[model samples]
Target: MPNLPDPLPWPEAVAPDTTAFARQAILNLNRTIFGFELFDRSLAQGTHTSASDAALLFNVLSHAECEVLMQRKIIFINCTHDTLASGHLELVPPERVVLELPPLDAPQRDDVETHLMALTDIRRRGFRLAFDQSVLTEPHLSWRPLASFIKIDISHASESELSAWVQMARQNPKARLIAEKVETEAQFAMAQDLGFTLFQGYWFAKPILLSGKTVRPAQAAIIQLINLVRQQASTAQIEDVLKRDPTLSFNLLRFINSAGFGLKHEITSFRHAVMMLGLKKLFRWAALLLTTSQGAGTSPAVANLAVVRGRLMELLAADSLTPEECDNAFVVGVFSMLDTLLGMPLAQAIEAIALPDTVVDALLHKQGLLAPYLELTVACENADDAMFAKASATLKLSSQQVNWAHLQALSWTETLVD
Candidate 1:
């Protein structure tokens, strides 16, 4: 991790508010959780930077892509202490949400009391309370009312410590146990034996390359169409490519007219859209469409997460680089997770996609102009401050900048998906 300069202020460009983003994020969460219960809270709202007026903000933020529609299970969401205290819980359906109590710290005694009071009230109303990141197994802590679920982390636990924790869980038969960071098959099996009903970890959603075979032929054609558009091919040439696939042509026309594009005139033909959007803009949008289309069978939240990463990286670099470079930064950010998105190897994905050398190097080799930036982004996502510091120092970025970028990522994600 290298030190970097202060993050630049947020850009004036506002992201569209749409339900599509939220649906995508929720779909992604579903895939990340294979058999265990999964829950979500906007990172921004969780940090208390914004108020969640809508209960479905989490769902909205998760579904920005078609991939989000693939999820089939229920996911719990956290309601902030403030929201609970304000009695907003009355407006929310308790059955759909699991109010998560903030961690108890020495300075938060009063806040904890208030939260507990709210939780008790809500539970009486048929809502459930969940305890997150519960590493403390003290008897005093254990005496607190049983939660609907308890989240535990074994990242730092020894075998003896884990066994003790498991024994403790057994002691509380009324509560459901969730093991987070179950990073290996062995860990997952152990958790299952411990009667843990839920799990989350990189092992379940490790980024991999997508083989061309996995992608439907229509999707592959869309990718080829995007490549042609990227080359500044003429409308006639682009139309010819699009005409080769009727399904894509129809979808493209529908998308262009939808509220997503807000086109004043309804364009019924693919060639007409190509002529109207011109080469550059057409290509940019085509790439987006292609990527999003691939999201149909995957988790939309994961795809939007990639988009958030790209937007944050680009915004962070806005002040230090040329517009062209900033665009490259955005490309580097989104494509950073291509392997995960494609369900293929990173090297293979890059080989298949004809991205610029800088983007290619950053994604595949992680040793080019944008590699450090990508590294910083990953560290931030994992909340590894030490790695963030190293990247900031190396990139000459300020802590404020880093913090701002992180916050913006959260904020942008909230707005885009929610």
Candidate 2:
């Protein structure tokens, strides 16, 4: 791992009141998880300085547990020229991470040459580089060859313009084209036809509603198990529910033995696992099972996002809310995606499960005491700066706290593998 600078240059007082990083998935043509593009939601346009870029890098590479998760897939991070030259860039393994170099706002010939030198050095050190469509301009031609990925914002270009960019990007044999901000099925199809190899945006997370769709039986069983655990049912009763659904029993046992649990010995029986986990932990585990149930048409990314949201909400509310309210906060986070997961309206999907009013209010109506925490959790995932700042102010949480908790939640979700 590369070491950060001895004394980081970013000043404490100049930092924004809210600094939160959100990741947008970079998917392959098949719509599978390829990598994540991490960016700061609180940063306003044209405000990405060396200080802000370095802060983002520090937050990512600082966590030891996250290193394992990060190693599993490619990570795309936006970089300024200054960050490219920063020592922390040396700490990140070049193969696992792609440094996205943005175009200069006002291109000067001398400045462009200097920036190219920096890009060359970084690439020579084994780091892959990505550029946005601005690289298609004549002034950026010198930087094009170094690109390993080329991102084209589909929302900003017409078909002909996008085609031209795709053609230009293909001149670099090593570059893989990414269609950015693809929000609809049509955009996805057009990009696919344009020979784009990767995609990023909300299109994949959108719900495809069916008039008569409801929860699958296996999912309903998991919900039932969750409710039984929440009610603190007798061990025999819990075991009975598990016995009726072998799939749920297998999932429970598998979860207990997973690396996240850190259990030394495997407990084969449902009753044994129940006794070991107890009510509180078991209820949480069952809720996870419900989200991860093999529902048709649900993206794996959606399930993963739900878990991250739940954990983030719980952590953010830990210091302020009562223990029970904090637990409700977690529920609000996890079930926030119920509508998409179930392929129905959120209200309709939430009806299948039993929850406290606090959880229901936040999930369905975005009201109640836990609503602010939910807002903050979703704000961390969105690019809306005002929403993030407003939520932070409403909760009186600082940027450092929210940023730390968000990374912790991501690390926690990485521990739970199917």
User: Model 2 RMSD to the real structure?
Assistant: 5.4
Q: Report the lDDT of model 2 for residue 265.
A: 83
How much does candidate 1 score in TM-score?
A: 0.64
For candidate 2, give the lDDT of residue 315: 86
State the lDDT of candidate 2 residue by residue for 268-381, as single tens digits: 988899998889878877787777663675568878888888888988888888988888888888888877787778778878677898898888787889999988887777
Off by over 4 Å in 2: 1-20, 41-46, 85-91, 106-114, 156-161, 204-211, 230-237, 257-268
Q: How far is candidate 1 from the true structure (C-alpha RMSD, Å)?
A: 8.9
lDDT of 1 at 393: 82
- Alpha carbon lDDT of residue 348, candidate 1? 66
TM-score of each: 0.64, 0.85
Question: TM-score of model 2 relative to the true fold?
Answer: 0.85
